[model samples]
Target: MRGLKKEARLPTVYEVIGVLILFIVIMFGFINLLELPIQLALFTSWFMVIGLGLWIGLRYKKLQDGLLQGISNGLEAVLILITVGALIGTWIAGGIVPSIIYYGLSVISPNIFLFATLIICALTSLATGTSFGTAGTAGIAMIGIGQSFGIPLPLVAGAVISGAYVGDKLSPLSDTTVMTASLTKVDIIEHIKSMLYVSGPAFGIASLLFIFVGFFYVGNSVDLTRAEEAMGALQGQFNISWYMLVPPLIVIALLAMKQPSIPTITFGAFLGVIWGFAFQGIPFLDAIQTSYQGYSIDSGIEFMDTLLNSGGMVSMLEVILLILLALGLGGLMEAAGILHVICQTLLKWADNAGKTTLTTLIAAFFGNFFGGAAYVSVITGSKITEENYDRLNIDKRVLSRNTEAGGTITTPMVPWSDGGVFMAVTLGVSTMAYLPFLWFHFLVIIITLLYGFTGKFIWYTKGKEYTENYEDSTVNTTKFEA
Candidate 1:
């Protein structure tokens, strides 16, 4: 990995802003006007970075080194992404994910269906640590069940997305959680602990909203015939046993012990393969193959087939590429001193801890909106604001928490973004249709900003003295000026 040379000239703030505007225009033009996929759009942006570096008078070697350094930082996350993909494939084949959905479906009644939908999806996503996986599997089942109960599709979609993302933000197994912790140099457990102060309240309030909504549809009678048929098809294809839970349980236990993420997730994937072979009676060869090619189920039920037939190492290739390309662009900007210059400009306004936190939050949202990926937003926000946080004596965990609160939760709100597009396509509901019902997403933004302004949960550190202070720290505006 390359470090920025002290002698390298930094780009001016106006030049950085111009490059950013150009970058956004190119990306939006490709994705919206030209109708290209996100991968191609990202590729086009990488070239823009190269051109920007040259225009700024940076040597080619310096720019290339920055790109490589940025890509290197994400290598561990990429491995974890591939491992989680394999885990999903094997978990489905082993009946782990299916069992959760099957059991969740069996317990819900029409009256509490909406509330239960949120809880079930949350639990499934917590277990799998993947919002997309949860959405494609249990989320589909919830949609079918909700339709059967005559609930509005948008409401159901909202509950599913909210619950799925809650787990994605909190779960130890979640890639976003891992990436956030790593980027901020905070212990994974500490990052999660800090997040609870924000996510816990947001999730609780959202659940209550779902419950309130549930009251209206409680007595409305509808058929459960289709849901039963789907459950039957799942049961027929897989063993659907409690024993399938061993893998996720082990993962949680290991994470609680503060075990490293990569090995823990890899072990979980291996346990899933063993369980599939031993209990599900999947052929040994097929179990191994599924880790790479994904689980294949021919239940003859179209919806069931669509939901269950996902995961495997191949499924993560797009995400891996996106991370690499986005990080590369970030690296090029850093190498050319553009990121540092812009962040320094932002720091001019961050005269206090509260304003610093708010600045990070604002930057994160803009990162998701302009960068077009949650990973990009997280990396960009964390990298730029980390030193400002350090200078303000703020705990890194708080930085990681805010990054996720703003970046991860806001991506799905942008309709053209990859996260938004995936959720809309998976649930067959437009992003705009479900936008109003996404209480959890909206709540996170509000809660984080509230905490920033109010300093309710800010953790402070100054030269080894740690304290939890709820009172807002007075802004020393002149102390942090360049």
Candidate 2:
């Protein structure tokens, strides 16, 4: 945004509102009305945003700079996607995926598989402090195991996402958890305590829901033969063993040590390829091809073929394309002054404790909708709301909690966000398809809003009165340069 911010004037209020409305129209309208692909919707929106930038007098060079900055923000996720694609292929070739499927089929009950998926993924993400790593490893394996158990993929994905996000929000090692606290100068412990009030109940309720709903599927029958068939197919193809888990364990160890995500994931991928070639006796050329293009097999059985035939760098092409379009549009809109003006407008509604909290949540969602990254949205949401929380004498942890409500809790449900894209591609479940099952997320929203309106858990400055004199105080909202 360097050159564009210098050359472009702040957009008029009308321009800002128009862009938001137009984006909604295209995002929801085309997707709902015409059943267009999300990629196409993003493409059309990017095109329209470019037109708006030029109309606002932004030069091409400045616009390009803004676009690059936006893409730079999301570059880490795109890189992970590429490496994860390769990781999946290599893991499959290495006998790691097959081992999980083979052993998992022998034990997990179909009736409680989803409940187990929730707990397993939660522990994994909590331990590793990464939703992507959990998803690409355990989450993906759970999906295969769930499919074998005659469970629905969407239901399994819902459980995986619920567990992954729960851990990501709570873990001290998580970027969002750390970032949210740092932004407000609130202690990370205080931040975690604040979130637990709402998240605790949501997690409990979601666990039960998964259990109850999972049992409903067993209404017909639990055919153990289906699982046996899958296990047999896996055993026939690979030298499945308990130690095959070591590769994923290395991934967990590296992430826990806070290594760079791109290289860690890349190392995991290469290790899988080498392990597959060395141990599985897969041909050198075939292993190399699987690492690049993807694993392919003609296992005669349709379901087995679908489950095993996946991965490679090439598979992430569409995900990479969507990331560029969404982030590029976000960058252009911000450089054109649309996002800045939008932030300024939203602050006008934060005149009281309830309104202030509500505004924080809305702003988080707005930032995420336009920013294409949850961590970036955290910056915009918390920065814009920080002053208001101070003015109201509300605890800064309140700001951190509410901001995370949008920034982390509901992010995976927003299809255009990086979090959403990763979940969709990894689990093979669309955001909308898995949304209903993200019971914890929906419950958190309701509870967070009630906390804001009812003044429950809205801790104010301890030695000060809960002041209602916000009117006499002069207020100013600084524009966030996201």
- Candidate that would win on lDDT: 2
User: What lDDT does model 2 reach?
Assistant: 0.82
TM-score of each: 0.75, 0.90
lDDT of 1: 0.75
lDDT of 2 by residue, 258-351 (tens): 7877898889988888878988999887887787888887766677888778889998898888877788877877667676566667677777
TM for candidate 2 is 0.90
Query: Once superposed on the true structure, which residue ranges of model 1 sit more than 4 Å away at CA?
Result: 1-8, 110-114, 117-197, 217-223, 352-354, 365-404, 407-438, 454-482
Tens-digit lDDT track for model 1 on 416-470?
Answer: 4556755775576888899999999999888988888888888888667444332
Q: How many steric overlaps does candidate 2 have?
A: 0
Task: Give the top-scoring candidate (TM-score).
Answer: 2
Error of 1 at 2 (Å): 28
